[model samples]
Target chain A: IAGITQAPTSQILAAGRRMTLRCTQDMRHNAMYWYRQDLGLGLRLIHYSNTAGTTGKGEVPDGYSVSRANTDDFPLTLASAVPSQTSVYFCASSDTHSTGELFFGEGSRLTVL
Target chain B: AQSVTQLDSQVPVFEEAPVELRCNYSSSVSVYLFWYVQYPNQGLQLLLKYLSGSTLVKGINGFEAEFNKSQTSFHLRKPSVHIRDTAEYFCAVKRAGYALNFGKGTSLLVTP
Candidate 1:
């Protein structure tokens, strides 16, 4: 499909392990975002890229890093995973950084033990 | 910074009954409003949005929301809901060129 795709639908890793959640969009959008969905917390932005080669922090960017070397891919990495980082991660893209609707991927569920 | 608040963390109602999910936001500038629904273990899908037009915005699956600028509220409503409507509903706001700020979310439980 010509939408966002995320890999490793679900994963279990040990604490301090390095992990990466892959996200790619075929829509050729300029804006990409990473959010974590928790039980009570609806969804919080972790990192975002306005365009290729530009990255910015979000409300909860701690413990997470992202790189946007190209327009199609925006991968989020957990340098050293912690149990507190366990949550469902979602990747979304928009046509522009302004008033465009978002298209989201299914999700990547990560569990750190 | 813009923020959203879904007053009711949980709403329980009977099938076929009317329901409302309240949402409020805090922003100093003009913003766009949106409502999204998420099924179990799935990502969020846009339910509806209010950009510039009538305050009453109708969405998919018989859901609608009203944008009350004075009140800073955009509450989701359904005249009659179905079991399929039982899911997590999120209210979000966005300023220009920025990612959305989502509310905690309201879990709607439709019981028969």
Candidate 2:
């Protein structure tokens, strides 16, 4: 079912460059999220959407922006990439209910030089 | 705001030995707890969760965790570990109407 899929499995971007991390899910989930995983630090939330057209800031939303244009797509954009933004990004989706389990994408490893 | 704390950053154990990963959380209101596993170069996957049921929650891969309200803890335990169990484990808490809060992950290394 391709639960959740992220684009550009891995990438190398120069500092100050703009990049977008695409996330898509076929499950038609109402909620989607973006998170970054770094060494020692666990997964930190970057942005989230409760449903189509509604997005919210998360724990670590700096340097990142997200839009939920539809139920299937939620993309994260970095206006200006920085070395601090270099980390594995994951996309996740969950059903309308918060109690439901979350489905995660493989991940997008971004290296900013 | 809710927060999670994973007591151990790394745990080394041998195959067939029991292992435990401790987790503590602080929140102003009641919350749901979960444990997720991430293999090398992979995304996080749900290992188990503690909702409103019994204290002990059993999940896939023979892993289990117990939720303690007074202690504010949800410790993951596996009676016998396998080489495949080597991975990073995360403890998470979901506050009402909020995103999940994850603690620093615990890297479990199961040696043969």
Best by DockQ: 1
Candidate 1 lDDT, A14-91, residue by residue in tens? 999999999999999999999999888889999999999999999899999999999999999999999999999999
Clashing pairs in 2: none
Write model 1 residue lDDT over B1-112, tens digit each, in one string: 8889999999999999999999999898999999999998888899999998899999999999999999999999999999999999999998887888899999999999
Model 1 bad stretches (over 4 Å):
none
What lDDT does candidate 2 reach at residue B72? 98
The fnat of each candidate, in order, is 0.75, 0.78
Window of ten residues with lowest summed lDDT in model 2 chain A: A94-103
lDDT of 2 by residue, B62-105 (tens): 99999999999999999999999999999999876788889999
Against the true structure, what is every candidate's RMSD?
1.0, 0.9
DockQ, Cα level, model 1: 0.80
Worst 10 residues of 2 chain B by lDDT: B93-102
Candidate 1 colliding pairs: none
Candidate 1 docking band:
medium
